[model samples]
Target: MSTRGGGPDRRGVRAKVEAQRAAERRAERRRRVLLAAGAVVVVGGIVAVIVVNFPSSSSSSGLGPEGMALQTGPQLASVSSAASGQTVDGISCDSSEQVAYHIHSHLAVYVNGQQHSIPYGVGVVEPVPSTVNGGTFVSASQCYYWLHTHAQDGIIHVESPSQKQYTLGQFFDIWKQPLSTGQVGPASGHVTAYVNGKAFTGDPRTITLQPHEDIQLDVGTPVVPPQSVDWSHAQL
Candidate 1:
């Protein structure tokens, strides 16, 4: 009789132990869920940190083969001429003692139909002083790249490497200014680009820099006769 009476009690204790084990399992699952959520949050925070520390679109840029998203911004250094001397990216610059090449091109920039003067010594590391009413675009400097301006007349002197295609956007990039369809440095308006007096339907960055080729960019209304370079008067 006593043994039979104790059997029910034993069964009740076994059921209680089983219920405790089930509750423990549920609690463990909840802990795992919380841990997984925490890991995701931590990982997300780390990614955000990395992105902010990396370079922005306004700096550190390169043009693709098709001139896609060509960043017309400042460079990491002065093309690092000090480190590499007269050659970079397998391209050579003017000699340390004298100008090696003197190929010239014409460039015209207008904002609201008003012409903007290209500054002299724009790409030079040691810039020459500019005088009022007249500015030398390409001021003599130690490390002269092929792309430079000698005066505000908008003539681009490819005085470094020879027989290499340069782009108009690269000139702006070296000038440390923004160039886009909607903006050119501080001038902001509708931009229209022309290559050799013909309307450029492609990205402005694709304008191939060529000798005596007139590249005009108007930001605002189009001027009559098109603001092209005066080939007859261009100081080639």
Candidate 2:
């Protein structure tokens, strides 16, 4: 009778040990899983940082404003400015769009008195806005941003939904061109500016783009009168 009772007790102890070992195995598996998940999280964060800091494909190639590629030429060289102006939100184009029913603005650039072209493309939109510069003109649902260029009028068509103060400095940024206190494009000299025929007192880059406003930037010698934009019918 004593031997039989001892055998039963010994079997129960063995079962308890087996259960404890199983519990420890489960705990070990969970810890390994947690470690793997933490490693994945760290790797994902690093990738996101790289994408944000690097230039996007569209902007990387100097393409901006109405699908026009920033034309590199003998006189023009790529330059960056420390002055980043207030960016007016870009929007789709509209046939009936206007600065208001009655207000708009213009921009002009001159180097050595001769008018420097404000380039071809400034504020342009397409069906696939991001792929606009990828070539192939997209019309139909085409749009326009606050600052845009049409033809060689040297005008920045600030056709917005309402009347809000815009800046010449912002216009330059949209054009993907360079402008500063004493430099416009490849031309570097004393910079002079005018607003509605009145000489600007402060930095030329900060000139206000009010409705029917005419802004001019002149670099180097020969400061001719800024070509006037006849507001008589100027509605863009």
Top candidate when judged by lDDT against the true structure = 1
Supply the global lDDT for candidate 2. Answer: 0.59
State, as a TM-score between 0 and 1, how close model 2 is to the true structure. 0.50
Model 1 residue pairs with clashes: 120-136, 120-137, 121-137, 137-149, 137-150, 137-151, 138-149, 138-150, 146-160
The superposed Cα distance between candidate 2 and the true structure at residue 17, in angstroms, equals 99
TM-score, per-candidate, Cα-based: 0.53, 0.50
TM-score: model 1 vs. ground truth: 0.53
Per-residue lDDT of model 2, residues 1-236, tens digit only: 24376587778888899999999999999999999999999998988897888757855454333322332323332213311233443444454346562345666667786666554345554222223334333222455555665533455666677767667777666655667878876789988888888888797767777766778777888887866655443334
Native-to-model Cα distance after best TM-score fit, residue 59 in candidate 1, in Å = 46
Query: In model 1, where do residues sit more than 4 Å from their true spots?
Result: 1-102, 129-138, 222-225, 233-235
Q: lDDT score, residue 199, model 1? A: 88
- Clash list (residue pairs), candidate 2: 65-122, 66-124, 92-143, 93-143, 93-144, 104-212
Error of 2 at 48 (Å): 71
